[model samples]
Target: MTDTGREEVVREEVARAEEELRAAAALLTAGIPRVAVTRAYFAVFHMARAVLYAAGYEPRTHEGVLHLLSLHFVKPGKLAVAHGRVLARLHKYRGEADYGDSFVIDEPAAAEDLVAARDLCERLRALLPDESNRRE
Candidate 1:
């Protein structure tokens, strides 16, 4: 693709990520703990994907984002560490939520996960400048 195509993809990802962030925030406030935790994963995924998109890289799945972050060579920070651990929990939770009988994630656990996820999202947001002046 051309330079124009890359820029467009980045813009699209930024828009989608910001929307996900807003949805995550709403879910957090509305007491939908499970949905909030899941959307928080999406929020962080999109936020990280936006950065990769701008750098001319293909994006990954939500779980892939977490896996990549877990690698020590990439963006070593507290957020990344938290993202890795939370991602492991999310992977298990997703599997249980889909296929396990009598398995569930409680509100307290979801609430705790949401906080970690939100913190990771915030760290990603801080890494990028606002949309209006995002010329990188």
Candidate 2:
């Protein structure tokens, strides 16, 4: 993709991250912890994608995104290992929340995931250029 195209993708992913965060919060407020956990994970996932796209990467799968994130950012110490751990943890929790027949995400767990997701998104957002600098 051209630089403009990549920028557009990055912007879209950032928007998605923001939207997912809102949805997660709303879901949690509505007493839907399971779906909230999934949305929380997605928030961080989209933020990761945005950061990767800003750096010219386009991971094809969720695992690919995690691997690339560790290889490019965490291993290089551009991001803290804790950030990577949070993403991985959320990924695992999201799987359980979405796919595990008997798995349950309580409100507290979903709330913690939301907090972690917000932190990860903030950290990832820091790696990108300021919003004002990007073309609309």
Candidate 3:
């Protein structure tokens, strides 16, 4: 695909990430904390994909996404390493919430995940090409 096509995909992913974050918030409000954590992790994961797409890389797996983000953005000083840490933490919590039989996701934990996901998406959004530029 052309760079233009890639940018469009990135934009779409970013939009999806935003929508996922909103869904996470809704789930949290509805008192489904565990599911909220999973949704929040996906929001950040989509944001990571957008970043990778803008960088001309499309990772095929969750680990690939995280690895690319660390190599391209965090290590290169484009994004702070703390963002990577937040992503890692979210990923970890999401796995526990989803797969662990006894995992407990309380209100505060879900709220923190939501906030972290939102911040990560915003940071990645700034890194993507402007919509006007990508449209052309």
lDDT of 2 by residue, 5-102 (tens): 99888999998899999999999999999999899999999989999988999999999999999999999999999999999999998888778998
Show pairs that collide, candidate 3. none
Q: Each prediction's TM-score against the native?
A: 0.66, 0.94, 0.91
Provide the overall lDDT of each model, using Cα atoms, as 2-decimal numbers: 0.61, 0.90, 0.86
For candidate 2, give the lDDT of residue 53: 89
Candidate that beats the other on lDDT, 1 or 3, i.e. the better one: 3
Local accuracy of candidate 1 as per-residue lDDT tens digits, 56-97: 556456665555555531556634555556656765665565
Cα deviation at 136, candidate 3, in Å, is 16
lDDT by residue (tens digit), candidate 3, 19-117: 889899999999999999889999999888987888789899988998999999999998899999989988988888878998887989789879988
| Clash count per candidate | 0, 0, 0
Q: Whose lDDT is higher: candidate 1's or candidate 2's? A: 2
- Model 1 root-mean-square deviation: 3.9
Reference-based lDDT, residue 90, model 3: 87
Lowest summed lDDT window (length 10), candidate 1:
127-136
CA lDDT, candidate 2, residue 55? 93
Per-residue error for 131 in candidate 1, Å, reads: 6.0
Candidate achieving higher TM-score, 1 or 3: 3
